[model samples]
Target: MLGRIAPNLLIRIAGRTTEAGIPPFVDLLRIAELSGNLPATDPSSTPAALLTRFPHLAEVTFEDVVVPGPHGPVRARTYRPPHPNGIGLVWVHGGAFIGGDLDRADAHWPSLEFAHRGIRVVSLDYRHAVRGVHYPVPSDDVLAGWRWAASHARELGVAPGALHLGGSSIGGNLAAGVAKRLRDSRPGTDTIPAGLVLVTPFLHPFGAPWPTGMLERMRAATTNAVVSPEDLTHMAWNYAGRRSVLDDPYAFPANGDLTGLPPTLVITEEIDTIRTSGEDFAERLRAADVPAVVRMTPGAAHSSMSRPAEPTAQVTLDAVAEHLLGRWSPRAA
Candidate 1:
């Protein structure tokens, strides 16, 4: 329908002309304005904001509980399906290993979509590196969530073997770390997730800490300075922690071999800085015959899944649900 309208339709519908040299994003802005219930500017402490913003959505219920983490106790919210569940996603929220709780902008969609598709998603409020918590704390907490989900599978209406783990951005990175830990901890069983969903994850944070440019700009936007580029570099190292940081897969998942991980789905925004890393992990995992499928969205930017309703984020979740529900009947990719 959008393509049917002339470009001048903006002026007709929005009362604003896309005059000379304007980026294509004007239409998106107009659409968001019309929709009006998209994520609020502040999402961390305000998730009912989305509930009020998009009331058309249904078939989801949120339950809060305390689950045991490797370090200690952690908070988690389980997104339940209206129907029974066949698959569950133990999801970690993205905040660059620093910030973000389950109520943040990104964790909102998977809860609804996964539930609607009859898939359960346990969104973990993992201990972050900020506020003196770090590395294994977050990863271990997610692994613990998986164990809890598996143990309570019958209660959650899922089969024992259908649970999966995934996350976006740093969440994806932590999910990868959890995968390695699950494999190492549980041998000779499918206790690990049936598959993995990595969305523009930060898998290679060691020898390469974002190539010293745009990512640095993003980092700076989120953190104030010491004012030197090297300070930013050291900040990453310190966040990962100096001792045994390399061992933490969130900082460097490439160190671990991806040989028998699981069937995998990867989503990357076109302009996301982590796009290359996500695709790289996909290629490596597929080479090992890990059943990896990667989707590189056209015209989507970094953290596309977090804010606004972009086709890339929407379609990626659609494919994930289909694959999990065994309804992936689309023409072969």
Candidate 2:
């Protein structure tokens, strides 16, 4: 639609150009080639490359750090803005709950961005991947980080009562799970997040590899099918401990009871398979009397924010800032 609008017509025209009938499987092939494919698996190395690429990103400042989780230490980096902090964002890093580190660039970028907007951001580098320490384990570590942050909110310059939880991709999934748990725990009247900001969140695990009823969408599309069906099945089992896929809350938040979650902002790219997760969760949150909003970015794919200065990339960050600033308003309960 932007292609038909006013000036800047040429750029939109160029961006809009695509094979008229190219299969969506083409997207899967490109993503599959890169999704689980890692030339260097170290989390720090992954973000270091991005830091080298985007030199202008501000450096992260840590006022305090902690790794007090039970199973193992998860490093946390806190980013504090200049003045009295008005809001706090407990950010969980994304790595399919198996791989991530606060020392890495990807983990720091979002927090750095939040700090620049005057919100105190704590990024978590929780235990990941290995058996006995995944899924809800990561969720536990993130909530631990949040508890630590809340305890230190005053010293960290955060406001009297404003802490919002945020995450991206799988981290967002963990945050949603943790938020539900926190809601039920209800430690006290004053100990809970104000809202949730989810970016390209993977809210559902039951999404089939292909669209429903597509018997051979990729039969001839050799370039597609990232993470073979075998890997998908294995990941589900590994994530939820060998349970039937039908009733695993860890696997799908959309299928869970969301009666009391905070207001939520969920941004999804149309090209990602997990887009369904974001949309369904947002709608469900609203249906259950929780405030929620779903924002979609066109002409983009998942993982675009980690890439360079694409329009969608900046838009994604802007959405994060808006949520932190209390500019986002999901429907009130």
Candidate 3:
């Protein structure tokens, strides 16, 4: 085992690579050199470092805000565009409920790119499910962030009707829960998001059945990075603080009604173990008559969003931007 290396150590390793003008791909390779337990050529490179190498483009800028939360003030960053398109996103980043920050690649790059293209993004820094924090805490924080954004949409330069809620990985699970809570608790039309964007999400504790032989083919492949169903079950149990809470629909949206949810776009990585969870949840949404579209970035592994320099990550990011801009048509169910 590599043992638990301080995150700062990994950050330093990635930071040195970034300063040397090394490609993002090599940053993780250096980290993986520590042990075989770590995947060689993995997407685990800290995106916060790699992305800083690029020059800032356009007139996009960001502001830090303190939003009121159930526990206390929640930290958030808002990315603003020179021109507003009336679309805004309340974004969440993923770390399996225990880690991740606003600067993570999933949250930062997308917010910057979307803002450059004329959409505003409010990225949340919610409480993680660590140090006795559990379900409904992180959920409550996201709900609080959404409420703040919705109530101040005009001042935030976003149309109330066009504000969206979205997240990736475990963050997606949190976003889905917030959407469900708003649907059930608030009856007003303006409370819900215009649509949902879920990427490489883990929706089910035990994922839907894999496409026939898909699991076998993936395992046979040489990739050292893979997240299995058992891995997801462990994450769910940790977030819930107990096995029973997994049944809580708000904790895991797959356990609740899929009807009446907003139109959604679910993006998956081709070789990820969690791919089926997103795909299956989208189909369930469609079966419930909610408009849902699912797409897979070919040859992508999990955490593709973390490597923005890669062509596959670019495709994934474009899919989300297109969905928000209404520029791309959803694939037929």
Please report, in order, the local distance difference test score of every candidate based on alpha carbons.
0.66, 0.63, 0.77
Model 1 lDDT tens row, 94-200: 76565567777677666676777778778887876654565667777877887898788778877778888888877888888778777777466537788788877
> Runs in model 1 with CA error above 4 Å?
1-46, 186-190, 206-235, 247-251, 309-311, 329-333
After superposition, candidate 2 runs with Cα above 4 Å error: 1-56, 83-85, 186-190, 208-232, 244-251
Q: By TM-score, how accurate is candidate 1?
A: 0.75
- Sort all candidates by TM-score, best to worst: 3, 2, 1
Candidate 2 per-residue lDDT, tens place, 44-151, comes to: 334555566555444545544776876666678888665435788888866555545674434666676677668888888676545354456667787788778778
Better of 2 and 3 by TM-score: 3
Report the lDDT tens digits of candidate 3 across residue range 1-333. Answer: 332555455556567532212323234434443442222232344444444544553367888899998799998999898787989999998766766677677778778888888998999878876666788899999999999999988998898689999998988999998899999984664478988899888778666678777766765652435655555666677678887888888899988798989999999988787898898899899889999999899888776777676678889988899889987755344
Between which residue pairs do clashes occur in model 2?
29-223, 29-224, 47-105, 98-129
RMSD of 1: 10.7
| Residue 25, model 3, lDDT | 28
Using Cα atoms with residue i matched to residue i, what is each candidate's TM-score against the true structure?
A: 0.75, 0.76, 0.83
- Sort the predicted structures by lDDT, highest score first: 3, 1, 2
Q: What RMSD, rounded to one decimal, does every model reach?
A: 10.7, 9.7, 7.0
Give per-residue lDDT, candidate 3, residue 79: 88
